[model samples]
Target: MNDDPRRIHCDRHGAQRPAFVCGHLVSGVGLGFVEPEGPQDEDASDEQAAWCDRCETARLAGGGWTAQSEAAAGITLVCAVCFEASRARNTHWMEGVARGWRHTDAR
Candidate 1:
């Protein structure tokens, strides 16, 4: 059996899958995100990770994840499928362009 702490059952997925996302994303509606660079180059199955726009602004204002910014993020664990759903639900072309997300498609 896999002993990975990240492997947990999701009420929706009902299976062990490793993933996590911020609270805003779990309840996101076109909420943009800031993630590691080069997302467009990666495949969909690549590790899904992102923090919402509010967190990004706080991070920039604080010059990094200060205690306040970290608290505001409220990171939560979720299944891989849920992570993908959040990603899809939140990502928007116009929003990405406005936020200057570095992706070829956003141009």
Candidate 2:
């Protein structure tokens, strides 16, 4: 019943989990959202597609990364290949968050 948005339960232990980002989950850590590539069945507009910030590639074929956020509440489809690449680039940021959390817990 902990009313904290930053805290989540730890699956490994019954301890109050600190707010930390997993690099394996999404690109980098921090509080940013990630939309992994998947499939799309319905007709979507241009804005619904996920654009690669690195390669500037746009997914126009099938399912791709789809994510919704406060700024972009609609579905954003991204290509699988590009999404994976982006994830790799974001791993460093995730590691940083993990390190910061560990340091804070040690105090």
Candidate 3:
């Protein structure tokens, strides 16, 4: 009977895939949450999550996460897999797909 809320049970991923993300991600409206720069930990988990530029500004407006900023963020809990998917959709990419380049090539 190990009851730890951090170790949540996701309906899709079974159990023990604790993660959290901003409201925009849950709503599928990714807002450019870039990945942390430099070397990453070997764990390879994107569960760190992030906030949009606007939200971040508000959060740090007074040098910290104020009550209003926290409310504006509206953090949401999600499975590890789901978190990864959100990160993929939100993070910026250095390269564009061939299909996207096709338009420039035609002109």
- Best-fitting candidate, scored by lDDT: 1
Candidate lDDT (C-alpha), each: 0.76, 0.36, 0.65
State the lDDT of candidate 2 residue by residue for 4-62, as single tens digits: 64344444433342422223333432233334356544663322122222211222221
Q: What are the runs in model 3 whose C-alpha is more than 4 Å off?
A: 1-6, 34-47, 95-107
lDDT of 2 at 104: 52
Residue 84 of candidate 3: its Cα lDDT? 79
All candidates: TM-score = 0.69, 0.23, 0.62
Please list the residue runs of candidate 1 whose C-alpha ends up more than 4 Å from where it truly belongs after superposition. Answer: 1-6, 38-47, 95-107
Instruction: Give RMSD to native, each candidate.
Output: 7.6, 13.5, 6.7
For residue 92, what is the lDDT in candidate 2?
A: 50
Candidate 1, 17-100: lDDT as tens digits: 766577899988788766756535334444556888888899889986689887888978778888888877888778766768
How big is the positional error of residue 82 in model 2, measured in Å on the Cα after superposition?
Answer: 0.8
Segments of candidate 2 deviating more than 4 angstroms: 1-68, 73-75, 93-107
Worst-scoring 10-residue span by lDDT in model 3: 94-103
Local accuracy of candidate 3 as per-residue lDDT tens digits, 1-107: 42876567777776666676768766564465633456665875655656665676776685756788878878788777877777667654432342252325565
